[model samples]
Target: MSGAMRMLAGLYRPVESQTPYGGRSVTFEAMGSAWLACGARRRSERGEGDEHHAVETMSAETRDDPRLETGRVLRFGGADWGIVTVRPLRPGRVGLELERRR
Candidate 1:
């Protein structure tokens, strides 16, 4: 909530509904936007036999919002980031661990 906030990330909530065929469907509904101070990008690599997997993650700080929860979708920088974890940072701020979605 200060000048250090550089990114305006849009938050989305998952909405689940029951289908007529007794199936379930999930969709994202736009919650709102929040200013976040994104930290440095981190990358990790994993290998499983002959397969290799790369994951990109980053930390960000933003004002505490009740709708901001894990499994939510965040859209910014022309990409979608999945909320991996959320923790309270201070009285009104929360720390977020985001993973870049493929």
Candidate 2:
């Protein structure tokens, strides 16, 4: 972690559980928190006609953590961001692609 990576983002992993009526439910469990160096947020609009949606994409870098993977959720900046992609930038450095729909 570097001085620039000042934001603390909480990592969450998805957990699948069974319901009382033989149904399945997916929930997120807190894994831990990590220091993230977040980049600028990019916004895009989609859809046609009277309906349109905005999708926000952001990139973040953090130390290598085996628990982090695709589909995990990151809680930061008073919002929950979905982990779109994860890649290794270099030794001990992991890059994450995060997305949030608004």
| TM-scores for every predicted model | 0.77, 0.81
Model 2 superposed RMSD (Cα)? 2.9
lDDT of 1 by residue, 27-87 (tens): 9899999888988778887768998777789889988988888999899999888899999
C-alpha lDDT values of all predictions: 0.87, 0.90
**Regions of model 2 farther than 4 Å from truth:** 1-5, 17-24, 47-51
Write out the backbone clash pairs for model 1.
none
TM-score of 1: 0.77
Instruction: Give model 2's TM-score versus the native structure.
Output: 0.81
Number of the top TM-score candidate: 2
